[model samples]
Target: MKRVLALPYLLWMVVFVILPVFLMIYYSFNDMSGNLTLQNYAEFLSSNYIKMTLNSFWYAFLITVITLIVSYPLALVISRLKHKTFWLLIIIIPTWINILLKTYAFIGILGINGILNSVLEKFGLMKIQLLFSDFAFITVAVYIFIPFMVLPIFNSINGINKNLIWASYDLGASKWEALTKVIIPLSLEGVKSGIQITFIPALSLFMLSRLVAGNKVVTLGTAIEQQFLTNENWGMGSTVGVFLILFMVFVMLVTRTKKESI
Candidate 1:
């Protein structure tokens, strides 16, 4: 009966997930003539593509790190608040809006003659260039992805046994010590889940890269999109897509292994 209930989900995965992956694998290894060859892989493995992969990883890493740093503390504070649901809603509200809308909103705020610079000028301060830069890219990524980080950590913290925390304090442990030694260790699963969600999407965020950084930030996602849409090189696009899939699988495997080892 349980398996019967899950059949629809299984079918959905087969159609959406497994089928797309198989198609990507097929296309990645085939040429325009539909001849199977390694030429796509060879070209994609070149230095330029490798650099884009690394840059994507670096930017994603920065975004993940910043999100974690910001989220854990914010979650900690929010978890202690009486109006936790309200606060969480506030954090999540922006996510309900369209991504493109949010991106354009940032554009208005960060543009040269945008709200921020206008306010600075009114204060007799020199206007700062905020758009089309690495700073702008990362700031927007963090803004968009922070909720993914916060929610998981918040759930982990919320699920913790209050008695254990009380016990730690009763044993003469400082708040920081209790947090580091007890609370955080037990919350590793949530942190891992959050990182997976935040990092994976950030890794493939071509739209944000283009809108926020003005194409100055070249990522694997943007590269794939360009190959597929702009250059009409489906083979190369699938090759990059294959690389991204493998990279994500590698990350998940590595993180899971680390968790098992610990």
Candidate 2:
């Protein structure tokens, strides 16, 4: 009966998720002539693709680290706040706005004669170019991903046993020591989850790189987009897609917590 109730979901997964992956794998292994070949994979192993992959990883790592640094303190404060729900809602509300809208909003804010530059000019300072740079890309990415990083860490910190903290104090541990030893260790699962959430998507931020960085930044996702849309190289696009799927799986495995047996 339970399986019967899950049929719709199972069918949806088969049709949308499983079928698409299988099709991508099929396309990835076949050339334009539809002949099976390893040329797509070979091309991805070339210097250009390798460099792009490393660039993507580097950016993803930066985004994750920055997001973690900002989010951990914010999440810790929110967890201790009297109005936790309200603060969390504020954090999440931006996510409800369409991503395109958010990106465009940043474009306006980061553009020449935009709010930031206008403020700088008012302060008798030279206007710095913020748009189409690595700084703008990373800032926007961090802004977009902050809520995702915060939520899990907030949950983990909030769920912590207060007794343990008090016990640490009773044992003569300083505030910093208590936080470092007791709270941080327990909250690691949330940090791991946050990294998993932020890093993977950061690796494949195609539209953000295009719009925000103005093609100056070309991550793995941009490469995939180019292969499919601009170059019409579906075989290579599928190869990249296959690699991305593997990367996602690898991240999930690394972040997943193993259950201890009793």
Candidate 3:
């Protein structure tokens, strides 16, 4: 009876998930003439693609690190807050807005003569260019991903056994020592989950690179977009897509926690 009920979901996965992946893999190996070729994969191995891939990984790593740095303390504080749910909801509300809308909002705020620059001008400071730079790109990405990083860590921290912390204090551990040795160590699973959540999406953020960085930043996603949409090279695009999929799977594997057998 349970299997019967799950049949629709199984069918859905076959149609939507499994079929599309197979199609992408098939397209990745075929050239414009529909002839099977390794040319697309070869192009991906060239200097240009390799450099772009490295840049994408670097930016994603930066975004992940920044988000983690900012989020961990914030999550820790929120977990100790009187109204934990309210604060968590506040963090999550921004995610409810469309990502496109959020990105456009940043465009206005970061643009020349925009709110930030106008404030700087009022303070008799130079109107620095904020948009279309690496700083702007990373800042916006961090802002967007912070909530994702926080939620998991907050849950982990909140679920910690208070007795262990008390035991540490009784053993004469300082506050910093307790945090470093006890709390952070136990919450590593949540940190891993947050990294898996944050890093993968950051790697493939095409719209942010285009709209925010003004094409100055070309991520792996941007490369795929250009290949498929601008250059009309679907084969190469699919090849890049395949590589990205494999990389995401690798990240998931690396971050996944192994269960200990009793």
Candidate 4:
């Protein structure tokens, strides 16, 4: 009966997820001529493409680290609060806004002639170029994705057995020791999950990079868009997509291995 109920979900995965992945794999290995070839992946070996891929990793790493640093402490504080649900709702509210709208809103705030500089000018400060920079792009990405980082860590911390912390105290361990040795280790799963959500999406952020960074930062997502949309190179686009999927899988496996070891 339970398996019967899961048939719809199984069919959905086959039709949507599994089939698309297989198509991507097939296309990645072939060229426009429909001949079996590795030229699509080989093209990424060029210095320009390689550098773009690395830049993608670098920005994604920075975003993930920043999000994790900000989120964990915020999650800790929120988990201790009586109105946790209310605060979580507040954190999630911005996400309800369309991402494109949010990006444009940031433009209105961060553009040279936007609200921020207008206020700065009134205060006798020179207007700085805020838009079309890497900083602006990262700032928007972090803001947009921080909720993903927060929720998982919050759930992990909130679910911890309170008695364990009490037990550590009862055993003469200090608060810092209990946190470092007990809480953090136990919350590894959530941390890993948050990283997966935040980092992976950050790597493939095309629209925000274009709107905010204005080509100052080139990511794999941007590369994929260029190949598929602008250049109409489906094979190259699928190749990048396949690499991204493999890289994500590698990260997940490594995280799981560490979790099991601990």
The alpha-carbon RMSD values of the candidates against the true structure, listed in the order shown, are 1.7, 1.4, 1.4, 1.8
Please give, for residues 162-224, the per-residue lDDT of candidate 2 as tens digits: 999999999999999999999999999899899999999999999999999998998999999
Which ranges of candidate 3 are over 4 A from the true structure? 260-262
lDDT of 1 by residue, 1-262 (tens): 9999999999999999999999999999988777889999998878888888889999999999999999998988999999999999999998899889999999999999999999999999999999999999999999998888999899999899999999999999999999999999988888888888888888888998899899999888898888888988888889998988898887787667354767
TM-scores of all models? 0.95, 0.97, 0.97, 0.94
Q: Residue 50's C-alpha lDDT in candidate 3?
A: 94
Model 4: pairs clashing at backbone N, Cα or C within 3 Å: none
Clashes (N, CA, C under 3 Å) per candidate: 0, 0, 0, 0
Model 4 residue runs over 4 Å out of place are 1-3, 257-262
Ranking by lDDT: 3, 2, 4, 1
Error of 3 at 107 (Å): 0.9
Cα lDDT tens digits for candidate 3, 1-262: 9999999999999999999999999999999878999999999999999999999999999999999999999999998899999999999999999999999999999999799999999999999999999999999999999999999999999999999999999999999999999999999989999999999999999999999999898999998888888988889999999999999999988888866212
Clashing residue pairs in candidate 2 are none
For model 2, what is the error of residue 57's alpha carbon versus the real structure, in angstroms, after optimal superposition? Answer: 0.4
Comparing 1 and 4 by lDDT, which wins? 4
lDDT of 4 by residue, 122-225 (tens): 99999999999988998999999889999999999999999999999999999899999999988888998999998888888999999999988899999999
Among all windows of 10 consecutive residues in model 4, the one with the lowest summed lDDT is 253-262
